[model samples]
Target: MAIDILSHRDPKVATDILKIQQESYAVEAELINFSDIPPFRDSVQSIVENDETFIGYMIEEKIVGVLAYKEEQEEIDIYRMMVDPAYFRRGIGESLLKHLFATMPNKPVVVQTGKGNEPAVNLYLKYGFEPVDEVEVEPDVWIVMMKKAQ
Candidate 1:
């Protein structure tokens, strides 16, 4: 897989990222028993306007995974990380994360994932992200916030 920076002005790239985001976040929603997760509510236009930088993982010229983040002061807040379910277990997510770490070696990274999404939470833990907090976004739906310091 190869990683490429995405252009927000490119409608096609934004559309592709939105598609991946919806597909991936749907699983998280189910795992956490919440259907109103932010990613599921995002539109292509909103994605284009987000101001976060997006990096896409391409396999055979097709985008199969994407990672989005924004740098704030000393921290990088990861807004989204998604891999096509078909591409799960293929290391695409890891590559995207490694790209982020390599590109911004000194910045602390922060992310939130559904507390019940073991795969995602485990992946973050494996990458050295320590669980720092949990927030209940809805009645019983909790998101686990994690961070990795530089």
Candidate 2:
């Protein structure tokens, strides 16, 4: 298993990232009972044009997980955390989060996930992220925003 930076400019890389993203977000959509999560609408072209930095977790050269984030002067905003369902329960997401914390230390970290997604919320809470807000995005759907202080 290896984790490395992924260039969105590479078509093949962008395609792989998009595939993992769709598959992963599909699970989140089901958990939240909402299918309109923004990542589902992404294409390879859109991923290639995105401004976030992507890091991929690989096994034998195949990307099995991806984490995308943007670093700013005050904080690091985590945009996406995806692990292929076929590769779930293997610590891929935790590994990617650890990599981010290691590489971008001393910055507040922020992320949002489905309010009903227990696994994701637990993971963030386990790592010291506290729930800061909960926004209802749809009639019955909500998103929870979490933050970890610097």
Candidate 3:
């Protein structure tokens, strides 16, 4: 499996990305009003046209994962990231993270995850991301913010 990170907005890779989304976030994805669990969106033309802020991981020419971030003057704020379940536990997430650490300047990288999602929190911690704050989004849904830096 080859790893290729590309602009999150790449059009050629949307379909595969969409498939991964549909399979990964089914119900939780719908809570966000999404018909599917896309890291971003399939028709968000920006996913392919916007290059100022977005990144994705490709395998054998297909986009099996994605990482979207906003580059700020101080740190990179991650918007979303998801790996096709079939590709989980394979270090692809870590690779994308490593890529961010390698390319980000000097500010901490920020990310958010479902409050109860231990796996995500663990992944962040494994990469040195620590909890910074927590906020309630819905009456029952809380989000934990984590940050990491070089």
Q: What's the best-to-worst order under TM-score?
A: 2, 1, 3
For each candidate, C-alpha RMSD in Å?
0.9, 0.7, 3.4
lDDT per residue (tens digit) for residues 26-125 in model 3: 5334444333223445554645565445456776677766776888888789877778888788887788888878777878889998766666778999
**Total clashing residue pairs per candidate?**
0, 0, 3
Number of the predicted model whose TM-score against the real structure is largest:
2
Candidate 2 residue spans exceeding 4 A from truth: none
Off by over 4 Å in 1: none
> What is the Cα-based lDDT of residue 86 in candidate 2?
100
For model 1 the TM-score comes to: 0.96
List the pairs of residues colliding in candidate 2.
Answer: none
- Weakest ten-residue segment in model 1 by summed lDDT: 1-10
Model 3 TM-score on a 0 to 1 scale: 0.78
Candidate 1 lDDT, tens digit per residue, 22-111? Answer: 889888888888888888778888887889999999988889999999999989999899999889999998999999999975988999
Error of 1 at 8 (Å): 2.5
Which prediction has more favorable TM-score, 1 or 2? 2
Best candidate, lDDT: 2
TM-score of each: 0.96, 0.98, 0.78
Residue 44, candidate 3: C-alpha displacement in angstroms: 3.8
